[model samples]
Target: MNELPSIEQIASCVSGYDPNALPVAQAQEFIARFVTPVAAVESIALRATLGRVLAADVVSPIDVPAHDNSAMDGFALRGADLAAEGDTRLRVVGTGLAGQQFDGAAPARGECVRIMTGAVMPPGLDTVVPQEFTRSDGDVVVIPAGAVRTGDNRRLAGEDLARGEAALTAGRLIRPADLGLAASLGRAELPVRRRLRVAFFSTGDELRSIGEPLDAGCVYDSNRYTIHGMLARLGVDAIDMGVVRDDPAALEAAFRAAADCADAVITSGGVSVGEADYTKQTMAKLGEVAFWRIAMRPGRPMAIGRIHAAGPGSKAAVLFGLPGNPVAVMVTFYAFVRDALLRMAGAAPEPLPMLSARSAEAIRKKPGRTEYQRGRVVRGADGDWHVSLTGAQGSGILRSMSQANGLVVLRHEQGSVAAGERVDVMPFDGLV
Candidate 1:
C-alpha cells in the first residue's frame, strides 16, 4: 500500500494546477479518481419517486387520452354541412360527453350533435361549432354565421406522447411534473436508484452535544447537524454517528462501525495537523490517504481516503475528513462530497448553472487563489443582472451565507474588479 501523503506534499503535487479553473473541472477530476457508483435497483411508488434517479428508461405503455376528443363545448358537424352567411337553423341529433360516446355516425347535411370538452368525437364529424354561436329551440338548433373550418376544436389521440415511445431516459431525476406525467401514463410504480447510505460525525473534546450540560471551553456540536441537513437536501440516507472525543481508541471504533455498515464516512475537526488532532493518525493506521490539502480558501485542511476492510468478506468505505470551522465544512461539502454522493447514487453528471452579472461594487482578490464570495443578485430596471457582495468574507461567519443568493466567482489571475464589470455568478439554490 502507498504511504499517506502529508499536507505539504499534497499541496506540492497539485501546485502547478490551474487555480482559475471552474469548480466543475476541479470536481470532475476528484470524482473520477475517488468515486465509484454502486449499481442497485429498487421499486418505489410514484408518489415517493421525486428526486430519485431513474435506473432505466421509461416507455409509455398507452396513448394519452386513447381517443380523439373535443377540446371545447361545441356542436359536432360534418365540414360540408357548414352554411354560408344567412344560414340560421340546423337539426340536433344527439349529445356526447366524456366517458360516453355517440355511437351513431356524424351528422348529415345541415345536422349537428352537441359535444362537451373531452368528449370523444363521433365518427364522420370533421368540425365543431361552439355553443355561443348557436341557439336551441325544441329539436332545432341554429348556426347563424359564416362557414366554419374543418377539424377545429378537436384533440387527437396520442398527440402529447406516443405509445411505446421513451418518456424519460435513464439517469434523469424525477420531479413533480415528471410524476404527473407518469400518472397520466397509468404507472403505479417506477424503477429508481437505491438511496446512498452515508455515515458522518464531528470530532473534538471541546464540543458537546445539544441538550447536554455545557462545560468550560466546550461548544455545542454543530457540524453533525449541519452535515445531516446538507445530506438531507441531497436526498441521501445519512446516519449521524454523533460526536467523538479526541481519543484514538474511540475514533478507531467509530471508523470500524462506519466501515462495516456505510458506503461512506465523513468527519470534521480532526484532519488538520494540530497537536490534539488524532483523526489523521487514525486514518493513516487504517488506510492510505489519497489527498490531504487543497489550494483554496476556508477549506484548506481536508482529507480523502478509504478505510481498509477489517476482516474477511468486508468492503472498503470511502472516508472524508473536513476542516472544523462551520463555514469551511459547508464549502468543502459543496465543493467535494455533493458530487461524490450524486455519483454514488447512479446520477449522471450535471454542471452547475452559471450566469453573467455586472459587479455592483469593487472586489479585491489576489492572483494565486480562487475565491467564492457570497453575493446578492438582482435584475436591474434595464433588465440586466447585477451582483453585490454580502459584506464581510470571514470564514467563521455563518450569517453571511444566509444573506447570499449566489456566489461571485473571482478568477486566480484577476486582481481587482470595478463596479459594472462582468463576472460569473452561480446561484446557490440550484447547486447545493
Candidate 2:
C-alpha cells in the first residue's frame, strides 16, 4: 500500500467536517474520497472471472458473425423483384444450410434460394422473407406485399460486434453476460484485479463462539456469521479471526495480526464510549484513525481510518470499527463497509437503488438522523407496493432483520411519516 494522507487532513477537505455529528451522506462521501483501490492485475481463465473486476479493456479479435448471414429460415431474394402492392411469386432454385456454402449458381431475377437461420447469404441476394409468412407450392414461394422488406431477416457482418472493437471496458465488474461476450470474441482468459482480502472479528468479553460452553452473562456471537455472509456476497476473500476478548493486550494483538495479513480489518464493538473503549484506544495508538458518531439510527459510532503493524516491511490496512449490536453490525456494513471494499477492489462502486413505496402505518423519527426500518413490501389489491414493519425497530433484533425483505430508508432532515405516505426502500433480494 502507498502512503496516504493523515486522517485529520482528509477530514479537513470534507464540507462541515464534524466527527461528532456527521451526516450519513457526508460520511459516505468522505470514505469514497479517501479510499484507494488496488492496482495489481492477473490473467485468469474465463470461467473463473465471474464477479471479478476487469483490469484492462477486452478488444474483439474478430467480427462476431464473420460474414453476412440469414437471421431466419426463409427464401433469400432481391428487394426490387417484389411487386408494388400485391404478392410476388418466385422460384426456389437451391438450399443454403448453416455452415455449408451454396454450390449452385447464384439466384438471378425472379429466382430465390431457400435459406435457414445462421446460413450464409448467397451471392446477389440481400433480403429474406420468412417461410411461415409465405405460401409454398413445389419449387415456388409467394411473398406477400408489405410482409417482406429489404434487409429484413438479414444479419450483416460485424452486426453484433466489429473486429478490433472494445467488448468490455476496464474497471467493470464482470458478470455472466460479459463472460459470453468475451467468449464470442475468442478470449480464453481475462485480465482482472486481484481479489481483496478482508479480515474481520468481533470484540466483547461476553461474546463466545458456537460450540463453546454458554457461561453466565455470555451470548453466542452472531455478528461474525452475518459479516462473513455479507463479505461472501460481495466476492471478497474473507478471513474470520473469531472473537477477541476485551483485554488490552489481546485486542492489540488481534488488530496487529489482522493488519499484517489483510488489506482491511473490521472489528465490531469497543467503538462506542464507556466500558468498551479498549479497542478504540488500541486502534488510535497503532494508526491515524478517526472515531465518528454518524447521525444515523441503529448504527451511530464508527471508527474509520488506516492501521499499520509495528515491524519492518509493514503495510497499512484500512480499518472499520463498527457498533456492538447484532442488527447494527449488518446495517453499518451495508451503509458503509460494502462500498469501501468495492472501491478497494478496483471496481466501479454503485450504490444500491432505493424504490418508492407506501408506508402501512405512521412511524416516529427525528429530523436530524436517518433510520432504516426492516419492512415487508407486497403488492396490494390495488397493484401498488405497500410496506409494513417487521416488528420492533431495536438495534439488537436480528430476527426482524431476517424476516424483512427490504429496508425502508428514512432520510436525514425529515421528521415523522404518516400512513399511506410515499417513502424510499432498499431491497435485499440479491444483496443477502
Candidate 3:
C-alpha cells in the first residue's frame, strides 16, 4: 500500500502556491478542485421554488400581459380627438376591468371608452384620459384639459417580454420577484436543481448530542447543528451523521456511511496531527488526504480529502475536516464548502459581493497570514461607509460572529491598516 502524504508534502505538490493567498482566491481554487456538477431534476411549484438554482433557462411561452391593456384608471380615446382639447366630450361606449375583456369595437369619432387599471383597451382606442383629468356626466366623459397621444397609457402586448424569449437564464438563483415573473409567463411549475445531499458530523469523545445528559468535560455538539442550519439557508438537504467518538473504527464506520449516501461529508475536528486524532489514521486507511493547513488565521488546520471506495462497488465522497473551534469551523465552511456545494448544484459561481469602506480603527496582522476580522459597517448620513471591529478575534469566540454584519478582509502581504485606509468589506447576511 502507498503511504499517505504529510500535510506539507501534499501542499508542496501544488508548485508556486502561496499559503498566504486571500480567502477569495483560495476559495475559488478550492471549489474548482473538489466539487463536480450533478445531473438532477425536480418538479416544483412556483411558490416553493424561490432560492432554488434553475436547471434550465426559463422561456416565456406567452407574451407578458398577453394583450393591450390600460396602464392606469382612465378613459381610452383616439389621440386625434384631443388635437385641440377644449372639453372634448365623448360618449362612454363601455367599461373595462382587469381580467374582463371589452368585446365591442371602439367608440366612433368624438367618442371614448372608460377603462380601469389593468383593463384591456377596447379595439381601435389608442389613448387614455385619466379619470382625474376628465369628468363623467351620465353617459358621457368630458376631457377638460389633459392631452395624450396615440399609444399613451396603453401597455402593448409583449412589451415586458416577448413570446419564446429567454426570460431567465440557467444557473440563476430564483428570488421572490423572479417567482412573480414566472407567474406572469403562466408557469405553474419550474425546473430546478435537486437539493444537494450533504452528510456532516462532529467528531470528538468529549462532545455530546443536544438534549442528552452532559458528563464532565463534555460539551453539546453545537457545530453539527450550526453547519446544518447554514446548509439549510443554502437550500441543501443535509444529513446529520451524529457524533463520532475518537475511536478509529467508529470514525471509519461513520465516514463509510456518509460516503455511501451523501455527495460530500463534512466533519468538525480530528484532522489535526495529534495522538487523539483518529480522523487522520482512518483517512489513511480508507482514502487519501489532498491538502491541509491553509495558512489563514483562525482556520489554519483545515483539511480537504477524498474517501476512496470502501469496497468494489463503493464510490468516492469529498470530505472537509474543519477546525474544532466554533468560529473557525463556521468560517472554514463558508470559505470552502459553501461554494463547492453551490457548484455541485449547478449554481452560477459568483464572487461574494464586496464593498469598500474606511476603517474606523487601525488593524494589525502578521505579514504571513490572511485574516478575516468580524466587523460592523454603517453608512453615515454623508453616504460614506465606515467599519469597526466587533470585539476579540479569537477563533472560539462565536459571539463576535453574531455581532458582526460584515468581514473586514486583510490581504496576506498588507501590513497594519491606518484608521482611514480603504478596506474590503463583505456582508455576512447574503453569504451562504
**Whole-model lDDT, model 3:** 0.80
Report the C-alpha displacement of residue 143, candidate 3, in angstroms: 4.5
The predictions' CA RMSDs to the true structure, in order, are 4.9, 1.7, 4.4
Question: lDDT per model, in order?
Answer: 0.79, 0.91, 0.80
Window of ten residues with lowest summed lDDT in model 1: 15-24
What TM-score should be assigned to candidate 2?
A: 0.96
Compose the digit string of candidate 2's lDDT tens values, residues 1-432.
Answer: 455767777888899989999999989988988788887899999999999999999988898789889999999999889889999899999999999988899888999999999999999999999999999878899888898888889999998889988889988999999999998887899999999999999999899999999999999999999999999998999999999998889988998899988999999998886654488888898887899999999899999988887743478799999999998998989999999999999988887988789999999999999999999999899989999999998999999999999999999998999999998999999887
lDDT-best of 1 and 3:
3
Candidate 1 residue pairs that clash: none
Stretches off by above 4 angstroms in model 1 are: 1-24, 76-92, 109-112, 126-152, 213-216, 273-276, 309-313, 379-385, 411-415, 430-432
TM-score of 1: 0.81
Assess the local accuracy of residue 253 in candidate 1 as a C-alpha lDDT between 0 and 100: 88
Residue 185, candidate 2: how far off, in angstroms?
Answer: 1.1
- lDDT tens digits by residue: candidate 3, 269-376: 886655477877886677755446675777777667778548533687777878888888877877777888888788877887988999999998777667889999
Candidate 2 deviant stretches above 4 angstroms: 311-313
